[model samples]
Target: MKKKIIVAPLNWGLGHASRCVPIINALIKDNFTPIIASDGSSLEFLKQEFPYLETLHLPSYNIKYGKNLKKNLFLQLPTILRAIKEERKIIELFITKNSTVSGIISDNRFGVRSSIIPSIYITHQINILSGLTTFFTSRIHQNIIKKFDECWIPDNSNSEFSGKLSTSSRKLNQKFIGALSRFKREELEQSIAVLIILSGPEPNRTFLEEKLISAFKNDKRNVVFVLGKIEAVQKSWVINNCTFYNFLLSEELEHKINSSKVILCRSGYSSILDLAVLGKKVFFIPTKNQPEQEYLANYLEDTKLAPFSEVANFTSEKLKEVKFYKGLQVAKVEFDVALFSLFHSKRKL
Candidate 1:
C-alpha cells in the first residue's frame, strides 16, 4: 500500500493553494498517496485539479479585508487565532483516524503539524519585515515555525528572490526548495496586449477589479481581466476592446498569460513565481495596506525584475516603464534532492 501524505494549504487566496500544485505532483511521482485538505475556493481548486485524490474540508480563517488596512487586520485577530486552534484540533483528529498516514506538508497553515508524524512547513516569508508588530509578531511566528521538523523555503538560497522577506537574521534550518510554479515554460503566441489577474481577499479583490476596469475602459488595446472568482459561474464578455473572465483553469490561465504581451497582477509571492517562470514584463499593483505585497512590489522594483505602483497611484504610465525581468535561477537539483530525501527517510514504502 502507498504511504499517505496529507497536504494542506492556507486559505488566504489562490496563491497558497496554487504553489502546492508542484509539491503535490512531486509527492505523487514518488508513489505516495497525497490527500488534500483545505476549505473554500482553495479546496474547490485542488479538487478540480486532482479529481481522483481524496480531499477534506478543513476549517478556514475566512479572513476578510477592507480598505482600512489597520482596522481590518485588527478585527480579524481573534478570528485568526480561533482558526489556528481549530486547525490544530482538525489535524490531530485526522491523524488519529488514519493510521496509514506517513507525513504532513503544511503550506503556511501554522497549526497543521503532528507530534507523531514528520511535518514540514513551507513558506516564503521567514523574517517578517520590520514594522510596528515586527518585534512581537516575528518572535511568535518563529516559535510556531520551530515546531515543524523542517521548514522549506520556495526560493533560491544564494540569490534570494524575496530579498529580506525570506532572509532570516537568526539561524534557521531551512531547505531552499526553489520557486514552485504551476505554469511551466512554454512558447505560446502572444495575442493580447495585457492580462490582468485579480486575487487576494476582498473587498480588496472587488476593489482592484473595479479600479482596473475603470483605468483601462477606454483603451483600444486588447486586454483581458480575470476576476479570480472561482465560485462564480465561468463567463466571458467583451467590453470595448477588453475581454473579462470569471476564472480560468490552470492550463487555460497559463495559455492566457503566455499569450499576452504584458501582464498586470498583484505582487503576491505565488504570482511572482509564475511570472518569473514565464519571464514576462509585468506591472505589479500592491494591495492597499498589505505589508507583504508592498514589500514584494518594492523588492521586485529594486531588483529590476518589475515595476510596481500603489493601487491609488496606478496609471497607464506605469505600464510603459515595465521592462523584461530575468526570472530567478532556481536550483532544481537542490529542490529534487531535498524533496526525494523527505519521501525516502520516513515510512518508506
Candidate 2:
C-alpha cells in the first residue's frame, strides 16, 4: 500500500496553494497518495488541478483585512485564535478516521500537525514583519514550527532570493528547498506589454484591481489583466486595447506570463518566484499596511531584483523604470528530489 500524506495550505491568498503544486506533483510521482485539504478558493484550485486525488474542505479562518491592516489584524486576533483551535480539532478527527495517513505537510497552517505522525511545516516567512507584533509573533511562529518534525523553506539556501525573510536565524531542523514555482521557463514572443496579476485577501484584491484599471485606462500599451478569482467562471473581455481575464488555468497563465514584456502584481513571494522563473521585469505594488508585502517589495528593490512603488504613487514613469531581474542562482535539481529526500531519510531510521 502506498503511504498517505496530507497536504494543507493556508487560505490567505492563492500564493500558499499555488506554491504547493510542485510539492504535490513530487509526492504523487514518488508513488505516495497525497490528500489535499484547504478552504475556499485554494481548495477549488487544487481540486481543479488534481481531480484524481482525494480532497477535503477544511474550515476557513474567514479573516478579512480592512483598509487599515494593522488595526484589522489586531481586532481579529481572538477570532483567528478560535479558528486555529477549531482547526486542531478538525485535524484530530481526520487523522483518527483515516488510519492510513502516514505524514503531514502543512504550508503555513499552524494547527494541522499531529504529535503522533511525522509533520513538516513549510513557510518562507521565518521572520514575520508585522508592525508592533514583529518580535512577539516571530517567537510564537517559531515555537509552533518547532512542533513539526522539519521546517521546509522554499527559497534558495544561499539566501540570495529571500534575504532576511528566509535566512534570518536558521533553526537546526529547517531545510531550504529552493524556490518552487509551478511554471517553468519558456521562450515565447511577447504579445502583451504588461500583464497585471491581482491577488490576496478580499478588500485588498479589489482595491488593487480598481487602482490598476484606472491607471491603465488611458495607456495605449497592450495590457492583460488576470483577476485571479478561481471560484468564478472563467471570463474575458477587451476594452481600450486592454484584455481582462477572470482567471486562467496553469498552462494559460504560464503562457500569458511568458508572452508579456513586463508584469505588474503584488509582492507576494509565490508571484515573485514565478516571475523569476520566466525572467520577466516586474513593477510590484505592495498591499497597503501589510508589512510582509511591503518588506518584500523593498527587499526586491534594494537587491536590484525589481522596482516597486506604492499603490497611491504607481504611474507610467514608474512602470518604465522596471528593469530585467536576474533570478536567483541556485544549483538545479529535480523537484521530487527535495521532497523524496525527507521521506527516504525517515524510512532509513
lDDT of 2 by residue, 208-257 (tens): 89988988999998999999899546889999978999888788999999
Q: Report how far off residue 136 is in candidate 2 (Å).
A: 1.5
TM-score to true structure, per model: 0.93, 0.94
* lDDT of all predictions: 0.82, 0.83
Worst 10 residues of 2 by lDDT: 340-349
- Cα deviation at 137, candidate 1, in Å, is 1.4
lDDT of 2: 0.83
* Model 2 error, position 79 (Å): 1.7
Highest TM-score scorer: 2
Pairs in clash, predicted candidate 1? none
Q: Which stretches of candidate 1 lie over 4 Å from their true place?
A: 67-71, 324-340, 343-349
What lDDT tens digits, residue by residue, belong to model 1 across residues 1-349? 8888999999888999998888888888878889999889898888888989999778778788665665776788898889889988988898889877888999989888888888899988887654787767677777778898888898877636777777776656677777778887667888889999999887889988998999999888989999888864678998999999988879899999889888899999999888877777888998877788889888878887788888889887678887555433332331373564654555433
| Backbone-clash count (model 1) | 0
